[model samples]
Target: MDDLLAQFVIEAAELTQQAAEDLLALDCEPGNRARLDSAFRAIHTLKGSVGLFDLAPMQGALHSAEDLLDLAIKDNVELDPTRIDPILAVLEWIDRCVQHLQRVGTLPPTAEDEGAKLVLWLASGRAVTPAPSPVAGGTLPQWAAKLFDANPAIHRNGAVALRYTPAPECFFSGDDPISLMAGVPELVFARISTRENWRDPAEFDPFRSNLIFEAISMAKRADIEAIFRLIPDQIAIAHDATTDPSELPAESHETTTRTIRVDLARIDDIVGLVGELLTAKNGMSALVTQAQLLDGGLALSRNVAALQQDIGRLVAQLQRAATDVRMVPLGDTLRRLSRLVREISGQTGKPLQLVVTGGEIEADKTIVDGLYEPLLHIIRNAVDHGIEPEEQRQIAGKPAKGTISVSARQVGHRIELAVGDDGRGIELGHIRSTALARGLISAEAAAALGESDCLELLFAPGFSTSETVSDLSGRGVGMDAVRSSVRRLGGKVTISSAVGTGTTIVLSLPTSFAMSRVILVTVAGEQYGVPMESIAETVRIPASAITQVRSNEAFALRDRTIPILRLGDIVGSGAPGRSEEMLLVLEIGASALGLVVDGIGERFETLLRPPAGLLRAVRGILGTTVLGDGRIIMVLDLEALLA
Candidate 1:
């Protein structure tokens, strides 16, 4: 296989897998002509690409499937559930063939040689199409051979698909999936989706290629053909069902519907451009308003309001587009964890199964993807350390096979994912001893720590109860990594375990990646955000109310002494700034902290990306949120700043 063709083959495998998964989803409601068309195009593209490289096996199978699908669509062929298994079997065939080719120079011997068998099986999958009678003389006519040439030069499918199936054992080797994308021959567009389910990255074996791709193109089938041709069995193809004009209403109907199917990435690009435009318009309009006041008095101000109204409309549209791009089912993440639990049960010799609930909940896709790794680590750690072995469970009078239940629910604007397992829970004593020995906590503190306080130490670095290390799950042995990942992703993870019962790991993640209603406060001359969530209320307390208790400054309210952390004192003001009347009363956990600040400011929303380089070194700043007015406000790292 030539380099380009080989690459295409590799890409096609992934895209095809993705295409299959997506199509299967639209199996019901065959009325979704748009979806059906998209699925068909993916398969058709694959078949066309196979022909380019003279890949007989893959091309043959895909061509057969595409023809059946095409026929079905023209006459409303059912996306019968029974067809899914066989189709997946075909995809598996493609995967196996691709793996073999990647390892060796040649295609391995298989059913590909049995063309009669493939035709027989494919024919059975569809409505009975009359087979032409066999010719008496079994010789191809010269003219017929020329007519039936593999490279017919007709690109039937206008769109493409990219598929990925993380190997069942992919979790054993860590492979950070960027997505199911491939540089294929005649590419129109590509999407990345998973097959089966996701395994924990720690368990995903990188050595194995579990991801598959399906690309669509009518220009050339060369790229995918070379890579996928060798391993024909592991890949499958069909024509794009979406582009079939025979199905959709004419172009005239486009304007009547308020919504149109759009690629998410395109929407993301539009959101960014619109955001920049919104910012530029804001600055320009402000300048114009100022100029009008100086030059023409009230003339430009009249038009300025109109411009601002236009900007608001644009901003609203931008948000709708972005949200559409970011929205994804919570099930995507939960399904992955469910798969991980099954793998863990097998790996740890613990008889456990995951019972998943409420997966249909929706959340931002960015948060969902970032969450996969952290959730995986916590669950695996629970199995490895939180759960007892089958023998131990039996001795405890519990069922030999344990159960881990994962659930997701949308409460207000945030989504919560809980992983609960019925197994041996943590021993706080072990944690206390471990924390003290490791010097993470002093012996005095360990002795005074309550069970809940000591148990939290497990989230600290190097705090694991596993006596012996196994190779199945990695660095997650120290759950501090999980904590860090969660914090970085704008989420939090907490564990509650009852001795001799079970453990539940709950992760709270935001539904919005970036918001527009952030209230800003200044701490020690520097600005910060209290996440509106952790804010109870900001009150200006009398300076005389502040009193010292046990050498720590405090304020008493409602018979409660809340710890006072002068924002200027803890965050230093170049020099001890003047004491202020207002205190930012923030509640975290079970305690309250009063942070004195130089001033309180207006509230606005902005996109907050992680600080880079020097800014990251600054303490107590989770991230910086940009305001529509162009000011950047640092977000107070609540845990570090207050805890």
Candidate 2:
């Protein structure tokens, strides 16, 4: 294997991965032009690159895939969920092949054999066969032999030279450029350069596209033709060895583009700068407060204050920019699920249609990556447990084909993603019985819990409602993994189900690790801080309006009475003033109570950092907040309060 062949193999695998992902999106977004184009291009890219390697099997498979995808893109063939599984199977095969090559210096098993089957499957109904290779025998530059082959020569502007630029992602084919250059014809002079300039040697990858080329008598035309042949925009051949000689028409060459890869360490540098700006903004604020307290205020101090204000604005902008660095579109992980749905539906003989909404939603890159498995689990569960059988659905007055809808929405400082399905909902009694049998709950407790509560118990590990397990989903369970994933992100998951109606699972996660939230209330004759998310609502009651209920003081709210909890008692904050204290109705889960305080207050927002060690173990309070008035208020954690 030569360098170009090695590069081709690596690039082909990547293209297959991309094509599989694109195929998955087609079912969710019917007639999606971008996905269609992407799938076609990925296949074309792989087919073109694989020509350099002697892997005829992989090449044939990619050719078939490219032809099929092209047909769909051009509206020649219908794009349906049925068409995606074979593509995924092929992609998975290619993935395995690459893994084997990584472990051993040879292509895994018979990749071409599997690839050939996939190609034939895609092209079965098409009247036209796949296009013939532009090049054969090797990835020779255009002038050498077949059109697609690398190291092939080209003719451009009447000048010819052997030309080939290894893929930015190459070297997986098990080839070395040093030895590859030695094999090419008319070897005159050779030059090498990677896609990026090396600022640090340690960051450089020796095989990751350090493009090498040797040209001689190298008809300047041959080089130009080779460059123009492999890629229309990437190469050029001129009268002299001048970089980027205007060999092609300026109109077309000007449109050429380049991509750069930056290490994550560089991004962290920007985030660090943002942190410093925040710290500086805080320091300036502290300094200004001291200046105001000084006995004599200098005139120059006022100018310095104005400068500080400008810096404060600059810092705010910097902070927003830094945070934006973490935001990435969610389309990434969700794109390949269509393939999974198609394959599983085939195996189970169930018609599954995946509907996606708000795929354009963007969030922290880390969050998007974390969402893949959770999202997959929900989709799978919906198919297995949420959706009813065809006959059962017809009896329930539903369409024969069940619909599974996945949606993502931005809510406050959080993103809420939901997966819903039209199916026979959870059988509440079965869950209660299962819990009892598992020793997870006593008979009395099971009897006491509501139907919804019993359904929620399915999130426990090793719980499964499916009878006579199937390979698709009845292998123990997966919802527990879903809950665990969301929880690890400091998020929560909730499920709602109605028998013979439908089911919905919602995952709520913060946009970032920590953020600002404040709820204003009075305590100890002064205003205090509480997170707004912690407060369910507030009730105003006059001193004489309150009445006793069940031997305890309670307040009537919308015809429902709630227990009262005095803030002074909970925090030992001196005592409520003689005047009637305002009752703030706090709610979490099934628990709702009122906090009696000195007076009502205005709400505000501020970032709250979790305290260290055991302090974080305190359940009721989330974090402390500093108000505009410089008062420290404790932000209550309503989730903790209820749990």
Candidate 3:
């Protein structure tokens, strides 16, 4: 029963989100009947599902919403723009109820009243009026009145009256209808009767279920619904609201497939096991290397090396398969943003269009989940501060409607997600002035800063260019939070803007948080790991091949000069070697830099563990990993090192 309830919560949450997406889409493409049908179906299914839990309030609200949608479907009434808010309000209420149930194991005390108000408002297509009071000594059934009179507390709080009629062939469906009603929480009254007149003893079919079960329960409507969720079509629920809500009509299905729902903890366990397997594989590789070094001419050593290679291949395949299970397409997150854009656009009275591309790119589930808030902040900022008002946009020779383009794509081993707008770009001068005024940067420093450096000030804590605080922006926190979040994910955030064109913020993040492919390099006497994705090329250059430009050393590659920094000096490992040094070219945004190392080692994939203790605050080190030879290798953060 707990598992069933959990599943219901998950399904209901998804349905609500889908309904919101479909409704928003239907509003945009009013002629798209498919979207309209989808919206209706989502609400209809939600209504049916809520009925099983005996959540009177939720069922009533959804039932009214489903009816309205049904009417719209039948009468071909274009969804009135006014109706959208109420429809969304209904979904929001359901979401809240589900959350409440999840937290406290039952709906809130006001759920029934709140649901009734929303339903009344929806049904009237306007504000809800006060419902008339129920008559004293009302036409209550004898059983109901007796039960209530006996338990005054139940009567005062109200009770859910239930009538359950198991299907004639319900036995074949493995339903024990009597046990279902018997299990109703806080059951106050129960009565059983035959659905039809009794037949001859011999004529009675043992398999046919003719019992009609009725009961009254002090338990909340949601509890009653949950008790009968599996057989919703076989039950009826009534609460003591001013008016009785009707039951959801049942639909029959000829086939059903069972699904094994595994808890997220189980999935995390699998990922952990896979990580251990990767570490073990690394140890095996190191053993093979050691064996070859000790017996280079032995056939057994050669055969063992070949076997290690095959094992490495299989390990890589298994790691990928495990990682893939934890990945989900970005489409779900993008759709949520789409709905957000619509709501914000409506509220701000700015005609805006959200153009999403490459949403099909897959990302780690954990990463994607954490992205919502950061993306929300960016989108809100774009709508509120980036996009100009329609009149202003038209005067600027731009279209009346502004466009916010959100795109995601997998680039090498990193995922690049960019949010850009076709509106007024950020002003560098204003940002510099704001930074200086906020004491984030010195006046002289602000004055001498280039455009890119000035733009970076936007991410400084408590720095904003807005003259006044409004519903959005001016809080001096959004961009800073975005930067912090991306940094925590081992990602970087970059911004590009033109004075009047628009601003684009791009986030580059590793494709997998659990494991990564890295190139091992020996610096001085210590070995370090550099993310393979950051390395553009590796070349061995003679000491004299490097040219000194002023106080900095640089090297020319393909007619372009890149500044070079020695890894040993940067990491404080040791002095640089006089021999020909291996240099790794790293691409950082639009620029490239060269890092001088002692020598390059083989590239391999390894699980990345978070830094511990004092190393957590260390900027240039990403994480630590144990190599096969029991050596701990520090993964270098190329971005931070370059910074």
Which candidate comes out best when scored by TM-score?
A: 1
Write model 2 residue lDDT over 1-643, tens digit each, in one string. Answer: 3333444445655576578778888878767888888888887877666565566776676666666677776775557566676565556555545433432335644455456566656555321222211111112233332221333344322323444555555467554545545654454445555545665687877657666453543433433343333342234332221223343223122211121234656765676566555545555655666777777755545766887889877876776776677776666566557777887678766787888777677786667889887877787788887787777778889888888888889898788888899888777898888888878789999999886567668876777777657676766556777876676465778888888788899989887643454667677766556666656777667766577777667777888777776776666666743546477787643457876777667654344544447656775666665544455566665444433
Worst 10 residues of 2 by lDDT: 131-140
lDDT of 3: 0.76
Q: Kindly report which residue pairs in candidate 3 clash with one another.
A: 52-225, 53-225, 53-226, 54-221, 54-225
lDDT of each: 0.62, 0.62, 0.76
**Best to worst by lDDT, what's the order?**
3, 1, 2
Q: Is candidate 2 or candidate 3 better by lDDT?
A: 3
Model 2, CA-based lDDT:
0.62
lDDT accuracy of residue 306 in candidate 1? 75
Q: Which ranges in model 2 have alpha carbons more than 4 Å from their true place? A: 1-269, 272-276, 296-308, 343-349, 394-400, 409-416, 426-499, 508-515, 518-530, 537-559, 563-638
Runs in model 3 lying further than 4 Å from the true structure? 1-9, 13-266, 286-298, 338-360, 397-401, 409-416, 426-471, 477-484, 487-501, 508-510, 542-551, 574-581, 612-614
How well is each residue in 1-643 modelled by candidate 3, as lDDT tens digits? 3544665777787788789888888778777788888989999998877876879888988888888888888998777656666677788667756755754567766777778778777866674544311111023445445545665655534566777889999999999887787688998777788989888998988899999887777776766777776775676665544333221101000001123345757777777677677777677765666676774546666777787778778877877887778777777578688778888888889988999998778887777777888898888888777899999998999999989999998998789999999879998888987887888889889888887767877776786677767676545566878887786676778999987889999998876686678889988778899888778989988888888999899988889988999898889876845758689999865568999888888787777776889999898888887777667899998777766
